[model samples]
Target: MTPGARVAAAIEVLDDIEARRRPAADALKDWGLSHRFAGSKDRSAIGTLVFDALRRRASSAFIMGVETPRAIMLGAMRQVRGMSVDEIAALCTGQAHAPSTLTEAESERLASADLAGAPVHVAGDFPEWLEPSFIAVFGEAAVAEASALAARAPLDLRVNTLKGTRDKALASLAHLQPQPTPLSPLGLRLPLTSDGRGPALAAEPAYVKGLVEIQDEASQLAALLAAAKPGEQALDLCAGAGGKTLALAALMQNKGQIYATDSDGRRLMPIYARLERAGARNVQVRPQRRGGEGLSDLEGRCDLVLVDAPCTGTGAWRRNPDAKWRVRPGALDQRIADQDQALVEAARFVKPRGRILYVTCSVLREENEDRLAAFLAAHPEFKSLPARDMAEQAELPGLVAFASRFGEGLRLTPLTSETDGFFIAMLVRS
Candidate 1:
């Protein structure tokens, strides 16, 4: 398909998403199923355009003075793709399968529209309601931080130490030009393609042989901060799909026991195959039914209990831009409630003097520091451990400076840490 046709397809998909208030992936998939003539490259290009449009939706609307699908696409071409007015006009020629020519007002706006004086939320490409939260976390840099969150994310992988070393995995996946991650000792990163899509690492022989697992750098670091050692007993209380559970197993060198369970048992289904692929023998899967005592046997016995608590996912906007727009206040409230419950339940597993790693993929203060404050208040026996001290003890002293900013925990952001937004606090039972 020509570039013009791809742009038209993206606009249509965006329109469908807005009209039905559905996910962009579902809209794109339905479009692909109906239009079988579109090849793989065409679909990929359209999907990129759709996501890019969503990422810059607020800014595009602010510039174009309208929020229609066409306006958003046109604004994206100018703002994101760096296309000029003439370049954009060439694509929207009113030809077959092409968008209509831009109106006079749109052309004038494209030529002169500037974001220099736009509101923070508009320039940052995030929801207006979230402005205060961003400000509370970043202060004067909130807009810049939000803009960074709107940028594209690189593909990151964690080498499975249980099966192979990072150097070995890097050599095996050399064809993809993987680079060592800045902070994670076991991480490798692959740059996204020009079209903003990541390589199919899952299909690579190295990944098939359990050498690497696709995980964000922040997540890898969160597991690292847990400092799970060899022969230690660890528990992943909310181990959905067991990403961190597998990382903990690799950290333990397959020598210790790692019990993985989730409140929603269905989320644990994929962990079985993943653990097998990664050769993680130390992990024991304990799928839980609602209100069931799945880990009753191990209560008050674990050396570490990792609660990768649920959150608003504000930090992952770089990959799932549509979610930034769809997230509602009520959803955040529900996530906070869920995090509180997960922390309380996870605390039950930590032995005396043991640690509980409280984690969330959110940059919001309410979900990170505020939640930790509330947890410490309720559980007087547990005291907050300084994140820097924990990082130093874990042999990751480089994280000390970054972790120091949050006082009691470490907060990683795309702007600050070149990683996904993650907040980790280590709590020790007295």
Candidate 2:
């Protein structure tokens, strides 16, 4: 399909997404099923355009002074694709399968797509309700941080030490020109295509053989800060799919025992296959039970407890742009409640002097520092650990600069860390 036709298709998908208030992926899939003639490349291109439009949805509407999908698409061409007014006009020639010819008003709006007078959320391409939350964490840099979150993200992979070394995995995936990550020694980064699409990694031998696993650099750093030792006993209280459980297994060299479970059993199903593929021998899967009765035998017996608590996923907007808009005010309240409940579970398994690695894939202060503060206040037996010392001990001294100003933890954002937004803090049982 021609570029103009692809843009039209993307606008259609975006319309379905907004009308139904559903996920973009679902809308795109349904569109593809109905339009069977569109090839894989065409579908991919359309999906990329849809996501690009979403990334700049707020600013795009502000510039064009319209909220229609077409306006968003046209405005995105200027903001995201850097297309000139003449260039955009050429694509909308009213040709077969192409968008209608641009109106004089659209041409003028496209020519001067200035965002100087736009509101904070409009300029940042995020939900307006989140502005206060972002400011509380980022202060003067909140807008810049939000803008960065709206941009594309690079594909990151963690070298599975249980299967091979980083150097060997790098050599195997060299066809992609992977680069070593700046902070985590176990991480390798791969650039996405021009339209923010990653390669089909499942087809690669390195990924198939479990030499590498898809994980963001921020997550790698969080797992590293856990400092799980060889002879220690650890519990991954919220191990959804066991990403960190696998990381902890590698750190412990499959020597110590790591109990992996989640509040939902469905989320734990993938971990069995992942653990088998990664050759991780230390992790033991435990399905969650009704109430708070799961893992009762291990209470107060763990040397370390890792709680990868759930959040609004603001840090991952570059990968899931549609989610940023779909997030609501009530969702934050629910997530905070969930976080507090997870802390309660983590406290049960952590023995005296043992540490809990509290993690969230969110840059929101309420989910990170504020939650930790509340937990420590309620349970005086646990004291928050120093973020700088943990970084230095983890051999990632560079991360000390990213320590959270509001709490004893480190915060990583797309603008600051070139990684997904994540906040991790250590709390030791006294």
Candidate 3:
């Protein structure tokens, strides 16, 4: 398909997403299923255009003075793709299968509109209601931080030490030109393609052998900071899909018993195949039976309990730009409630003097520091552990400086840590 036709396809996908109030992936899939004539390359290009348009949706609407699908696509061409008015016009020349010609206002806006005067939320390409949360976290740099979240994310992988070393995995997957991640000792990063998609690493020999797993560097670091050591009995209370559970197994060198369970047992289904592929023998999957005593045997006996709490996922906006728009105040409230429940449940499994690592893929204070504060206040038996001290003890002293920015935990952001937004706090049972 011509570039013009791809742009038209993107506009259609975006319109479907808005009209149906559905996910971008679902809309794109429906479009692909209906328009089977479009080849793989055309679908990829259209998906990229659709996602890029959503990434800068607020800014695009602010510049174009309208929020229609066509205006968003046109504004994205100018602002994100760096296409000039003439260049955009050439694509929208009313040719067959191409978008209609741009209106005079669109042409003028594309030629001269700037974001300097736009509100912070519009400039940062995030929801207006989230402005205060961003400001609370980043202060004067909130817009810059939100801009970083709006940008594309690189693909990251964590080497499975239980199966192979990072060097071995890197050498095996060298065809992808993977680079060592800045902070995670076991992390490998692959740059996105020009079309803004990562390589199909799942098809690689290393990945097939479970030498590497597709996890963001921030998540790897969060597991590392959990500091699960050899021979320790650890519990992953919210082990969805077992990404961190596998990481914890690698960190423990497959020596300790790591029990993984989730409140929603269906989410644990994929962990079985993943565990077999990764050769993680030390890990055990404990599917929670409905209305049963959940891990009652391990209550107050575990050396470590990792609660990868649910959150708004504000920090992961770079990859899930559509979620940035979908998140509402009610959803955030529900997530906070979920986090509180997860933390309380995790605390029950942690042994005296053992640690509970609370993690979230959110930069919002209400979900991170604020939740920690509330947890500590409600449970006097648990004391907050300094994340820097824990990082140093775990031989990741580089994270100490980063952890200092937060009150009682480590916060990683795209702008600050070149990673997905993640918060890690360690609580020790006294």
Candidate 4:
């Protein structure tokens, strides 16, 4: 396919994404089905354009002075994709299904486009109203932090210790030359560039045999914070698909009991099957009866309660570029409320002396440090744990030095770890 056809395909994908409120991956998949003629290279080029457009949507629109998909793609090609005016114009010639020819005005803007001022800041491609919250959390590093958010994230995978060690998994995936992630001992980092190939791990023997699971480094660290011990009672409250629960089981060496439950049984079902494949004998799936004792039976019995609460998911925007744009202001408000409620309810399951690990893939204060303050205030029995010290407790020699050199807690920006922007706070019941 010609460059023009790739641009045209990107425009179509973007339109479907914006109109149907679907994700870029889903839109691309739908487009691939409809246009079976598009080969691997064409799909790769088109996917790149769509992701680049989404990564800097606000700035692309501002630079082109047009909010339509075509204008955004054109501006992205110029400013982000680094396509020259002549190249873009030549590609957009009078070809079938090609992008419309650039007008003189569009050409001028393309030739001399400046995304300075607020647009540059907003170019993180997040909702406009979210700026203040991000500012509050990130402060002086907001723009750099936001810019990191706009960039592509690397592919990270956790070496499922249940099946194999990190070194063993790395050797098995020798062709990919996956490297040990700097932050988490259990994680491996792959290429950051898309390179037009689909997820490269699907065919690997380790991934197929459940020796490795795809998870971000920060998430691996957060799950490590739970510090599940053998013969202890652990509850993965809000265990959506049980990534952490699976991690915790490995920590416990499958000796302790993990009562994984969710308000919605549909999500927990997948975890049950995953636990089976993982050979996690200590895990028991308890489906709740529509808010009726979802965890009432385990009240005050858990040694570790992991509240992987839902939030705005601001930290993970780099991986899911479309999410940052699709999330509305009202949605954020609802998310915050949900986090508060989940914190209050999940806290009940913690044993008097046990700890609750509250985590969110968010860079917002209202969901992280602020929520901890509120929870501490409401429940005097619970006290905030020094997260920096806890992350240090992981005792992975490298992370200890990293935390010592850099102050910890509340927020982990993209710039800080090149991982997701995550916030984790721990609380212990008195």
User: lDDT value for candidate 2?
Assistant: 0.92
Q: After TM-score superposition, what is the CA distance of residue 217 in candidate 4 from its true location, in Å?
A: 0.5
User: Candidate 4 clashing pairs?
Assistant: none
Model 1, span 1-430: residue lDDT tens: 8889999999999999999999999999999999999999999999999999999998998899999999998998887789999999999988878898988999999999888788889999998898888887888998899999988999999999878788898789888999999999999999888788999866899889888999999999999999999999999988999999999998898998999998888999999999999899999999886575677898899999999998899989998999998999899899999999888998888899999999998999899888888998999999998876879877898887677354599888999899998888899999
**Candidate 4 runs further than 4 Å off:** 39-45, 119-121, 192-198, 396-408
Top lDDT model: 2
RMSD of each: 1.2, 1.0, 1.2, 2.6
Which RMSD does model 2 reach against the true structure?
A: 1.0
TM-score of each: 0.98, 0.98, 0.98, 0.92
- In candidate 4, what are the lDDT values of residues 216-276, reduced to their tens digit? 8989988887767889999888888988888898888889799888877788777866777
Per-residue alpha-carbon lDDT of candidate 3 for residues 1-430, written as tens digits (9 for 90 to 100) = 8999999999999999999899999999999999999999899999999999999999998899999999998998887778889999999977979999988988999988889788889999999999998888898898899999999999999999888788998789888999999999999999888778999866788989899999999999999988889999999988999999999998898997999998888899999999999999999889887753668899889999999998899989999999999999999999999999888888888888999999999999999999998988999999988876878877998898787365898989999899999999899999
Worst 10 residues of 4 by lDDT: 399-408
Tell me the lDDT of candidate 4. Answer: 0.80
The lDDT of each candidate is 0.91, 0.92, 0.91, 0.80
- What TM-score quantifies how close candidate 3 is to the native fold? 0.98
For residue 99, what is the lDDT in candidate 3?
A: 96
Q: Deviation in angstroms for 220 in model 2?
A: 0.6
